[model samples]
Target: MKKNIKWLLLVSLSFVACNNDDETVAETPVTAGSANFSKYVALGDSFAAGYSDGALFKKGQDNAYPSVLALQFKQAGGGDFTTPYMEDNLGGFSSGGNQVPQFPRRSYFNGAAPATVSGTSATVLGSHVSGTASYNNMGVPGARSYHLLAPGYGNPSGLVTSPPTANPYFVRFASSNSTSILADALTQQPTFFSLWIGGNDVLGYATSGGDDSSPITPATGVPGVGFDGSYNALVAQLSTGGRKGVVANLPYINTLPFFTTVGYNPATLDATQAGQLNAGYAPYNAGLVNAKNAGFITEAERVRRTINFVAGKNAVVMVDEYLTNLAGAGLPSYRQTTVDDFIVLVSQGVSAKAHLTAGNGTAVPLQDRWVVSKDEVALLKTATDSYNITIEAAATANGLAFVNAKAIMDQLVNGGIRFGNYHMSATYVTGGAFSLDGIHPSARGYALIANKFLEAINAKYGSTLRPVDLGNYQIQYPASL
Candidate 1:
């Protein structure tokens, strides 16, 4: 009986031990997976550089996506990350005793509207950083993908001269006059890298209201190659020698608060006001019918272009080159803007409230940079799609983690994403995402971005870096900073 009791106790102990082994999640330690984070390097454009509120500053650098990512990477065997920080907490840089070309410092919402502080950066720089080896972050604001491969891109001497010009921000920390950004990263022979280029490629065009003067493709073509040769070249160099990295694709520019702040219907009117507005557009409606009957335009276009203002949130008239110009017959390029049309953020306070609705107003039609028309928006969409295709292909071919910037932007615009215990959206202020510029993301937004890259990295490289809590980061830095 004693022997049987002892055997029963031993069996019970063995069963409990087996259950504990299976249930304990804390037993396995998170690792950097197959990739090495000891020498991580980042390269790209403004987004990579931590540009925010129309400017780059010290705190912005601290909250950079790469900087935030490196924090997690550090716990998982990542090396110390570095950034080309501004001289002070006050945003903006002074060169040759004059402020830079942008609006002084950065713009910030004063709780009422976006406004810049009274002055600019008073601090002056003495010289650029000497050693190239110590540099980790090579993100240059306003740099296109091609610029990263372009030699002498950081040369201050070439800024006023020929083919290869210098970026002012790069001038502060560039190691040499002849080294390319890619070359500098190569010098480190980084085991890991993160590339978030290509936004500036379309950003200039988007902000300029579909101005084709700004090309998305490289200006200088490499013959016998496919589309986005520069991008492909960049990928090839970074992926060479089996280096692992993460790259982000372009997002649809229209989804940004820079374009989405103003709505299709902001013009609310009383019954009398609505009637007056309708009478004013009567000529436009009659012209549409006459043009359609004459076969100058389709009946669909006639309907599409006809102006109809309701008592609330009405669409405004604007010029459309597609319409037959009948200026001599009293009809011009004017037509009502469709829902597909996007009013720019600059038009937010001034758009529907000030123009086209008032009787005494010229009704000259909102034009140029005031809005991004349907045709323009469609063009941007096509270019974005094409770029993403190339980006995805490169990532798959090279075995690099791909970050879908488009998806992130879409989620932020449509609904909020969970970060920590809080919900974060892309809305300008309270959204805790975008900065006052309406173009760039705030510090918290960058944290979310870092987590996205980390997720892709963990999936592809098997890295187990934990994501940072978004609520820990600031929504927007004080304008004073």
Candidate 2:
């Protein structure tokens, strides 16, 4: 009787093992062109919103990559995709164009104030009241990851009590209570979703010179969610009910046109100007000598002096104390001063001068005031790594696809992909990829971004979506002065 029982047990275990093997074999592998995105929803910051040339205007917004992808998807048999778009006016940063109104025209304080007035035309993104279509895209221009989870975040009118009035992007799409962008998106019951969050969390800090003193915190912090916390929350909310989607990581701001476009090359200086620079630089050397005499640490002086020429038309070329040290250490030097550098330096000095100083000195380093320093770059990298970890973990946990946008941006700037007929670099204005602002992408540039997304999706979802032909998009060049 015992022998018979043991034999029966062995047979039962073998049958269970075979069933497990069958289940493993039944699991599908992702391949190109196999998966179809029938219904789609997209969420994230300015890049996702199709903000270009430093503004989110009608033409750029209409031609945003998401819209392009949606159109392509529809042609490929997917259903229509909608977005809470800014109808009458573009909502992000503004620039000047050929009688076509740019957005967020320069502030009064900035030397280059826009001649045109700035205000949002009262309209909603998907107001069926005016007979508009319900939008499925929810890419908020300045939204951080935590903003999405904020109870009143999507409420277009919930948080507008103070100066700068209200965010025009929110005002256009916001419904007092019932029609928050996120809530509306959730209610859509999307079959597929695309999310790219957490850019603004670090962006504001980076652009603001890494003060991090502002009230804003990453989704994990008390007053707000730090990047990690907010990212997880976003994944949790989207992944509920077994929903599958795609999420993209943030790119470093340094890679954008804003940073790369303003590089200084000492080689560009004329002989006379170079002599003047060498003369001006003598004081910096004197300062180093003084430090040594005064029993202060003798740091190496930077070879190049970064002058904020915009401080005044006649503003003297001030030595970049920050770059002085950096250059002394044999690091890369700043390119010569440009019109934009002057504007940014003056603007920052005026508003946040207290925070703009080098330790124990009235002399502000160019790296400290205008450009990103090695320390700040290190910090950004750390923040970026933390954010990417969260993004990858969330995607893995939720069975969603992840796009390494950071890597892609780096490659584009460092010569990774050559799109269209032009060999695109990440330089601002003429760089082919970035627009005038040096921060956002042009229409053709966005198409390249779309290809990155497609690659990730195909790899993870067993789908084969053909990348859009670069030739289909337009690349604008600066008008001759």
Candidate 3:
């Protein structure tokens, strides 16, 4: 009986051990499977440079997604990844004693709102960094797809020219006045690379309210002229010599907080103010009616063109080019904004509000530069799709990992993405995903992006790359820093 009891106890212990082993998750060893990580390069626009809170500072550069990826790559034999770091945390740089207004200092969340930190930007754009011939991170803040292949893109002399042929960010660290961005990257002989261009292709147009000043790149031109061709050419060059890389598609510009933060109907007018606005637009309304009666415009267009102000919340008046030309009747194409339109974030600024209060949108109609009409939004969507198609095809052709940044952005805008215990969305500052500028991502948000890149890289290369904990990154930087 004693022998039987001992045998029963041993059998019970063996069963428990077997169950535990079955439930346990095996730790996958870190590896760089089927790929070389000895030299890694990152090429993109502001996002790749970590331009958060409106500027690229040392801290932001340190937390840039490329830098984050390099840390993880270290475990898998990734070599040194150097960056063209700014001299100070102040953000902007000076060019010949004049502060470059284009590159302003980073903003911080002041108790109530975001405010630019007070300091003179000390980094000099003409001052080249010593001892570094080629940088791992080749991200230029305002670069477009075609800009990478343009000669003299880093020439300091081009900075003074009208429209500025050179980007100040690239001019700071470019190898030579004549070397293009692509040329510089190729010189480094990177074994692996990441490409995240195309955002700036449409960003300039969207931010400028689809105005003619920053025209959207044509969808069907050849390389160095159009988005599709330029993007494909970029991929082709990056993939030379059987190199492996990752490419991310462009996200919809409209979904960003920069375009969505301000509402179409933001003005709340009192009864007296409303009456005054109505009286001011009465002549234009009467002219519209006459134009419709004269068969110059459709009745539907007449109704859409009519500007009216209510005593409570009201849509601000702005120019809509899509409206039928009523210039013959001495009437401009004017209409009040609707929910479908997007009022740019600049419209919410103190100066802009004062400009609107001064009868710009009430008595006189606002210009096309302040609002993006529903028609213009559709144009942006079409262009974005065209660019994305080119990007995806390039990835497939090159046999590279592809990240659907559009889907990730859609998730952020529609709902929210969860990482560990925290949730992030595209809600400007409060959402914890975007920076104060509403365009770039916050530090924590970059960590999420890094994880996504890792996921794509691991899946494509069949490697085991560990993702970082979101809790390690901060949602927003403090004002003191």
The number of the candidate with the highest TM-score is 3
By TM-score, the better pick of 1 and 3 is 3
Lowest lDDT block of 10, candidate 3: 346-355
Model 1 steric clash total: 0
Instruction: Say which candidate scores most in lDDT.
Output: 3
Q: Write the per-residue lDDT of candidate 3 for residues 81-172, one digit (tens) a residue.
A: 99998988889887677677766778898888788888777898767787898899999999999999998999989988997899888988
TM-score of every candidate relative to the true structure: 0.85, 0.70, 0.92
Per-residue lDDT of 407 in model 2: 80
Show the lowest summed lDDT stretch of 10 residues, model 1: 218-227
Give the per-residue lDDT digits (tens) of candidate 1, residues 63-163.
98999988889987898888877766657776687766552477677877777765657545334754444478889888877788888877878766754
C-alpha root-mean-square deviation, each candidate? 6.0, 14.0, 4.5
Clashing pairs in 1: none
Between candidates 1 and 3, name the one with more favorable lDDT.
3
Model 2 compared with the native: what TM-score? 0.70
Error of 3 at 359 (Å): 5.2
Off by over 4 Å in 3: 1-26, 96-98, 347-360
lDDT values of the candidates?
0.77, 0.58, 0.87
TM-score winner between 1 and 2, please give it: 1
Error of 2 at 128 (Å): 11
